[model samples]
Target: MFGKILIANRGEIVCRVIRTARKLGVRTVAVYSDADVRALHVEMADEAVHIGPSPVGESYLRGDRIIAAALATSAQAIHPGYGFLSENPDFVDQVTAAGLVFIGPSAASIRAMGLKDAAKRLMEKAGVPVVPGYHGEAQEIVLLASKAREVGYPVLIKARAGGGGKGMRRVDHPDDFSEALSGARREAKAAFGDDRVLVEKYVDKPRHIEVQVFGDNFGNAVHLYERDCSAQRRHQKVIEEVPAPGMTPALRKAMTEAAVKAAKAINYSGAGTIEFIADASGGLKPDRFWFMEMNTRLQVEHPVTEMVTGVDLVEWQLRVASGEKLPKTQGEIALAGHAFEARIYAEDAAKGFLPATGMLHHLQFPDAPPQGAAMRIETGVRAGDAISPFYDPMIAKLVVHAKDRTTALGALHDALARTEVAGSTVNMAFLAALAADADFAAGDVDTGLIGRHQDALVAVAAPSDEAIAAAALAATDAGAPGRAADPWSSLAGYAHFHTLARRTRLRFGEENILARVSARPDGRFQVALEAPHDAINSHDLRNLLRTARWPGHVTVFEGAVGYTFAVPDPLAKADEAAAATGSLRAPMPGLVKLVRAAAGDAVIKGQPLLILEAMKMEHTIAAPHDGVIAEIATEGAQVSDGTVLVRFEDGQG
Candidate 1:
């Protein structure tokens, strides 16, 4: 094994690599950008180096800077963890040219699988089944449209160089093909710097199943089973599981063989994943699956595979990169228990899963599962860390293992419920709801599961009366003189011979609650619910309050959800003027990528008005109703959250 290695990445994956390197007694170096000076991964590394500014182009994407940092730190090899430079073929060549071992596949392997169109063609020649699509190089709009028609309606236009759902679109009709192609090309160019695309037939009821494959420079390769990544949102996997539900032994064998074949065909080295889009319409079958793409590095959901196979994939990567033979043959690896990994992200699940930025005031995960239960939480951010907009908003990956799929899923639900977070919008509630979903529990999942059940999954419930009372009590300072020095003075009611009583008003979302409290003889206060008119002990309410106050807001976690309440200031004006006439505000902070409607242009309801790109995703703002656009935000403008982007006439004229 190498004595020291440089992790050429950031966030959880960097920390993940550091953990394994430490176990192997390998010294590790971490590279960071301007925005990550205080990042968790930096603190965990044996040595740290500053690369460049926060913008990826100037920092993480700069292969030269990363190589210099590794050479300066005397790192024997460089581990490109997952994103950033992990899949960049040119970076691999650069690292090799620098005389440092790249702890991953060779440049040839990456190039062989980098472009989707070319990779598909390669797979077909290698006798691996590939989706029926036009992988040709013709980029003319008319030709592409004709190909889509040939492939039948509902064709998928995917950027040849795209991943993470970027630069991809689904067109269900011929009329929408032109627009979809243009948008896909633009996004592809912006994201991958490649405008080339491929048209593919969209499978009905598609299920994403990918096999974990590993290879050594000695020409040996093996498969570590498969992961079902069908639970997706916006074409990105949200939850991944090993030993796919309803998977038959025969089918598993065939898929694994095909995956191993694909890896060997490329002379693949280290860890890689061969993703397949299986036709679930007729259930999983050996002949019903087609190659999608190969992730040429360790995957974000590798933990589940590790849990089921009882292998440390990173350790294997290190061993293989050190010129060791394959750790185990295909027959040596055996599937153990079922496992599930839920990606916890710092985003508002109810608001289109919009990426959020804030300081993490409080964070906690469920305690380790019982001695025999396998549970893991992988994260790079702590309670006080900030979720910046410069990187992916992923908070952590929650993994659990059990005897069977049902039991493992049950464990997943409990784990999500026990997870706690505050000071930022999160998808915890949505995850919990998903775990409890009957269809999900029964293993009836696909890429469209989230969209099919979005209403229930994203629905936000109002805080209960008890929850509101708890928030109110938490917001009130425990050190206040009224409550600490004289409990009676804090009461909400008082009479000649009765306890004093006080009513406190609190707001949760758009609903307000009046909590009546009175001092009791036992030093505890009694709370009365207004709507339900139920009397409850204040001690009970206080016990349920898990809160943290920051500046002008208090966040309380209750019923597996975190609710933030703003402490109203009496000095502030209540009736602030509404937004200036017909103004449409930007929903979040982002760069105005495109202005679709010009000033004085008439638009109908739901018409695309402008596109705002934030956190590496594009969001289109649409007209609320029929109206003439009076003004529009300039293209390429940087707008803050809630900044008016456009104004419309009072009525169409």
Candidate 2:
């Protein structure tokens, strides 16, 4: 193995590479941008280098700067961890020209499968099955529309040069094809600098299964089995598992063979993934799957494969790049157990999975996984780190393995329920629901599972009465349960000193809550909470929700949703009750892409008011009710979360 290597990436992936490098007694060099100055990855590296500004274009994507840093640090190789410059063939060539190894597939292999259209044609030539679509070079809009008509209705318009959901759209009718094509092209140009696209028939029921394969300089290749990534949203993988539930021996053999062929076709070196889109309308069959695309780098879901195969893929990458033969043949590798991986992101699944940015005031997980149990949390941020808008908003990857699929899934569900995050909105509740869903638990999943069951899965728990009482108690004394911070009792209220109940006022959003607490005879406190349109519900003193407090703030977690409440100051102005006003606020920090509605324009509920772009996704802010827009924000302004973008006319609140 080499003495040192530089990781040309950030976030959890950087930290992930370091762990394996340390295991092999190799030092790691980390590159960071302005936003990641205090990032966890920077602190974990043996040596660190500052790149550029926070935006990826200015920092992580600067291949020349990264190469120079590696050369200066005497790194023998550069590891581009799965994103940014990882798939860029030009970067690989640049690294090689600078006398350094790129710890991934060769430049020739990456160029062979860089674009969707070209890769599809190449796969066909290599005798690998590919989806029937228009993979030609005709870029005329009318020609593309005509081809979509030929393919059939409900065709998919995908950017030819990039992955992820950035430049992909699904059109069900001919009338929407033109507009969808335009939008896809715009995003494609913005993301990949290539607006060219291709059309494909949309599979009604599809299961995304991909094979993990590795190659070495000696012309030997092997497969490490397949992973099922059917759980997705907008073309992004959410949950992944190994030994796909309904997979037969014949199906696995066919898939793995085709994957190996695809890898060796380009003389691929190092790690790569061959993704296939399977027709699951009937069932998984030998001929029902076709190559979707090839990820020429280690994937985000690689941990599940490691858990079952008992192999460290990173170590393999280092060894292969250092002129070693294949570590194992196909016959030597075998599956041991079932494994699952769920991506935890700082986003609100209820709001179309819109990404959020904030400080992680309180972040805690269950105790580290036992040695053999293998419940792992792969993360790059600690309790005080912030999730900024400068990069991907993923928080962590939760991995678990067990004797079988059923047991592993059960452990995943329990682990999700135990995760606690207080500062930003997260998708833990949705993940828990998906893990516990009947169809998923039975291994009956498809790409449309999340879209079909989104309403039920994203219904995060609302703060219960007990949660409010717990918040009230946390905000006042700010002490652990069964202990009081001061000698003053709840009975010491009013001018008289005999005995009286204390009323504490708190605010959660527009709702005002009053908690009446009285000290019991046994040195205990009982709380009765009163809210709008409800009786004075008595809270069970014996049971209080888990809470975390910081000075004047309190957050009570209710099944992964943190409900933060603040105690109002008696001397402050009483603005909490001044409601009935109209204001449209930005849900997260973003740039205002477009202003669909103008001032004085009348709009109804759910009508598009403006469009905001954040974290590379577009979010449309709609009117809340029938009202006339009296004021509006600029179309090109960048604003933070909760910034008022529009205000309705008087009495329209």
Candidate 3:
């Protein structure tokens, strides 16, 4: 291994690479943008270099700046840790031309697998099974629509140049094909700078299974098994696991052998993943699976693979990049136990999973195992870090392992329940529900599973009386005089030699509730909430919930959901007047992609209004009711959460 190397990425992947580089006695250099000057990876690296501004195009994607930083630091190689420049073949060539080793596949291999259409063609030539689709170069809308027809209804239109669920659309009918094609083209162009796309047959009950394949300079490759990534929302993987449920020895043999074949065909090197889309209508079979695309670098769900194989994949990457042969042969790698990974993102499941941004006032993970540390928490932001809009809003990944699939699923559920976060909305409760879902427990997974069960999964329960009591206690300085155990803590209750009580107001969701609290003589407290729900007597609320309090907010975590409340200021003035009706607000911070209406245009309820692109996803703002347009936000404008995007006329005229 080299003495030093630079990680050409940011966030969790960069931090992940640093951990392994340290173990190999490799001094690592980290590159950061203005927004990440204080990122965790920068602090953990041996040396750090400032790249550029916050936006990716200005910072992380600047290959020249990254290469200069590496050369200046006297680094021997550059590790493109999976996002920005990892799959860019031109960047690989540039790095090689700069007299530095690119710690990944060669430019030739990346080009071979870069474009989905081209790669599918190559796979077909190599005798690998590929999905039936239109991988043609014709970009005309008329031609593409005909291809979609040929492929059948419910076809999947995917951008040939990129992955990660971006630039992808599913058309279920011919009438919607035109609109879907335009939208997919625009999104693809914005995301990948490529408007070209491919149409594929959408499999019924499709399951996403990808194999982890590694190769080295000596033309040797090995398979570390496969991961089931079918648990998805918006075409993104939410949960991943190894030794896919319901996998038979014969089927595993067929898939793994095919994966190895794909890797060798490309002369792949270092870490890579071969993703396949399988038709599970008749359960997993050798021929039911077809090639999806190849991820030419490390994946976000790689930890689950590491847990079962007892191999450090990063160490292997280093060894292979340093011109070493494959560490373990095909037979040496053996699956031991089951593992699960739940991606914890900073987003609201209730509001259609829109990305959220806020400070992480408090963050905590479950304790690792006492011996082998089976439970792993991979995170880049700490308690005080902020989840900004410039990057992916994933907070961390919760991984767990056990002797069996059932036990591992249970462990994952328990871990999610114990996880705590504050100052930002999250999807932990949704993840817990998914882990406990009957279908998931029985290994019945598919690409559309979330969409089918979203209503039940995203249904959030009202905060319990105990949770409200805890929030009330934390919102108000109930133990202001002293700790609850202190004798003088109850002095607020004894005014004029009589028991006294004070009322406090707290905001739960959209309504404010008045809660009455009184100190007990036994150094405890009693809370009574005045709301629509029945009231319950408080009893030792301190031991019932975990809370984190800020200046104007109190977050109470229970049942895997965080109930955050706004503690009104005593002296602050209230709003003078409520806003008028017929207003549509931006659900989250995003750029206004297009405004579908101008002032005075009449529209019916649920009509197309505006499209806001946030967190790399486009959300169409629709008219709430039949009304005439009054004012609308300008297109290409960046709006924040709750910013009024469009306003309707005073009355439906």
Clashes of 1: 7
Tens digits of per-residue lDDT, candidate 1, 1-653, equal: 89999999999999999999999999999999999999999999999999999888899999999999999999999999998999999999999999999999999999999999999999998989999889998989888988888989889999999598888899999989888888888788878899899999999798999999999999999999999999999887899998998898888989999999999999999999999999889888888999999999999999999999999999999999998998898889999999999999988888898888888888888876733467999999999998887789899999999988878887887777678888888998888888888888888888889999999998867765556666666555532335645755555456888865665666667666666666766566666767754677766664545666766667777746777877665467875765676778987778899899899898899999998888667888999888888889999998887788988876542
As a whole number from 0 to 100, the lDDT of residue 455 in candidate 2 is 97
**What stretches of model 3 exceed 4 Å from their correct place?**
369-373, 479-482, 531-537, 540-544, 575-580, 651-653
For residues 1-653, what per-residue lDDT tens digits would candidate 2 score against the true structure? 89999999998999999999999999999999999999999999999999999989999999999999999999999999988999999999999999999999999999998999999999999999998789999899889999999999889898888788778999999999997897788778778889999999898899999999999999999999999999998788899999898999999999999999999999999999999999899999999999989999999999999999999999999999988988888899999999999999998898899988988888888786633457988999999899998888899999999988988887787677668887777888889889888999999999999999999999865577778777776766623444443445433354565446667787887788887765554455666678442322234533325787764568887655668887788788867754347988889998898788899999999998887888766678999899999999899899988888999999888
Model 1 superposed RMSD (Cα): 2.8
Better of 2 and 3 by lDDT: 3
Q: How much is the lDDT of residue 256 in candidate 3?
A: 86
Considering lDDT, which of the candidate structures 1 and 3 is the better prediction for this target?
A: 3
Candidate 3 local lDDT, 1-653, one digit each (tens): 78999999999988898999999999999999999999999999999999999999999999999999999999999999887899999999999999999999999999999999999999998888999999988889899989889889899999999888888999999999989888888788888889899999999899999999999998998899999999999888999999898887878888888888999999999999999989899988887899999999999999999999999998998888888888888889899999999999999898889999999988988765423326888989999999988999999999998888888887887788778999899999899888888998999999899999999999878888888888887776774446566766654556676568767788877978888877777766778888564454456453538888976888888857788888888788877765566788888899999888999898898999899998667888988788888999999999988888888877653
Better of 2 and 3 by TM-score: 3
Which residue pairs collide in model 1, if any? Answer: 491-501, 491-502, 492-501, 492-502, 493-500, 493-501, 493-502
* TM-scores of all predicted structures: 0.94, 0.93, 0.97
The 10-residue segment with the lowest total lDDT in model 3: 533-542
> What lDDT does model 3 reach?
0.88
For model 2, the run of ten residues with the poorest summed lDDT: 533-542
Residue 197's lDDT in candidate 1: 95
